[model samples]
Target: MDPSGLPDFHGLPDSPVPSGAHDSPSLSALDRRIAGCRACPRLVDWREEVARTKRAAFADWTYWGRPVPGFGPPDARLLIIGLAPAAHGGNRTGRMFTGDRSGDVLYEALYDVGLASQPTSTHSGDGLELHGVRITSPVHCAPPANKPTPAERDTCRPWLIQELRLLRPTVRAALVLGAFGWQAALPAFAEAGWTVPRPRPAFAHGTRVTLPATDGGDDLHLFGCFHVSQRNTFTGKLTPAMLREVLRTAAEAAGAPTRK
Candidate 1:
């Protein structure tokens, strides 16, 4: 562990499999490997720089300073894919969708739909839980200006692909937030053994696509929803009710039980 008490990942390979982590076939191992990645030089510098020069609001906190891993169970039936971690949100808390307005909107909707145990995700050990869902992103590192370059996105694709391959056995549905996530997830799905359509589906709010599994498993139902960014939520683009409805539909498609 480093001075921050987190695992030390200095000099680790950017990709996990190439570093001999493939031998450990478990989500936990994959997560550790992901946390140790230093693949994109730009992302590495930005995330660490933010960690060192802490935000005023989070000045007392010890930033994660590493790639954020997917949250929820390994056997989750539903997967929610977002673009990437927020600079001060996941990058600080070390958990996806935590400590930000976007997370507030997301977890609230998940709680309303019976997928999340709590409506607030303040920290990693806040007892938050997802019943049958896993939340992840194509780019695990927090990028500058809330955007990653296309090359950086490609460099991060392997991690998502590996994650999909691990989750393929049980993941029955995916809800992608935003066009970036939709674009990133489709190719990863195809690489992970799903049969994407000849002409890839376009992304739009409430768009749904069904992908057949090549391994003869259950079909993967893909859904799209507007990202829970403040810009979208505050502008009346993606309201609470709208987000909840998409969550409910995706949860049901995954055969995941929901109270509402």
Candidate 2:
């Protein structure tokens, strides 16, 4: 295990040279490369800095610090994309959508819909499992103020594209959480061989776009949802029922069964 005592799969503590994620032949390889990525200087600095100076609540915990990787099965049918990791969330737990309020809402919804084995994802080893869903983000590293610059988003696009390519055979639908993820994902889907529309549909809660595969493979149903951030959830902008409705619809679109 690394100095943090978490699994060694999260990659080295210090950022290495740029990881050529495009060359990854499998999802596992892509995840390792993503975790070791140091492509963006600003993100690299911010994530490491946050790791060193942890929040008061988690002062006794060892932070993951390095880039967080996607979590779930390689053959996931439903892919959920979000913005970058939360500095004290994924950046601390070493797994996407874990250890944060956003994750609390997301995992609970997934569990309610029978997509997840548990309703809570407190850490990497919490035994939570996604049935046929995979969670990832455009930016692997946490950024300052929970926002990654456009350039950083562009720089991280290749990893998402490669991941899409690897999951192309199985991923039939995607749930993009927020405008940032929606914008970032559209281009990556096109690059990964899915035929996105020319004008690119505008982002809106409950928006659905069907992207036909260039190779005549299965079509992808993309759904947009408000982010599960505290701002939305606390303010009732994204209620539990609303999130579950979107998740259930998207999961069904992917041909994955829902409990209700």
Candidate 3:
């Protein structure tokens, strides 16, 4: 149990595996490992606390309280990057952006743009799937206060790097959901020798950047938008129409035939 009086996923040694283990695995194999991760003790403790408290209204819901993994078609060209897992949202549901207020606006916009098969994200078992998109987070684990330190973000980069390597699907564009996701991808881009321009690029509702590939090929495009956190959505920092337009632009750049 944790300070919040909730059960921690780390308590069980045989639960899920942490990222970067020598599993000789595919995306699904990585998914299983991430489902039982206990690497970050701090995150594990905080997530358990959120689960235990139940928050009154969510008392009956089963808490996932574990690491969250990216989910979508293996060949997806559009990669959607989110900030981090939410306490009651991704941490409780064991799936990114599910079972929380953040997902409400995200899924709705996804459906409106014809990227999602459904308009709601209830739980991991809700059979949600993205037709041409894949969703991942900067930090796979739920951070205390939903803010991951720079070190924590660095620690989590290997997993994202591996995922991108394995899912090399001629990426159309990336939808960075917040400042953290944008910052997290920077190191990866630098490692790949992609030249990013100055002014560092700011995080806004619809900012875009193009990076040259290492192979001297076409540049990869990145789009920035506010995270789908409850605070942003409820406060009107992002709107459904704005999100839909971003998706449309990404989809157009991603090319139509790649959807298959």
Per-candidate Cα RMSD to the true structure, in Å, reads: 3.1, 2.2, 4.9
Candidate 1: tens digits of C-alpha lDDT, residues 20-82: 234338777778788878888899999999999988877778899789989999999999999
- Residues 136-171, candidate 3: write the lDDT tens digits: 886888888878888778777767776765555466
Question: Model 1: how large is the Cα RMSD against the reference?
Answer: 3.1
Q: Model 2, residue 30: displacement in angstroms?
A: 0.9
lDDT of 2 by residue, 97-142 (tens): 8889999999999999999999998888778889999999998999
After TM-score superposition, the amount by which residue 69's alpha carbon in candidate 3 deviates from its true location, in angstroms, is: 0.6
Top candidate (TM-score) = 2
Candidate lDDT scores, in order, read: 0.88, 0.89, 0.73
Better of 1 and 3 by TM-score: 1
TM-score of each: 0.93, 0.95, 0.84
Report how far residue 65 has shifted in candidate 2, in Å: 0.3
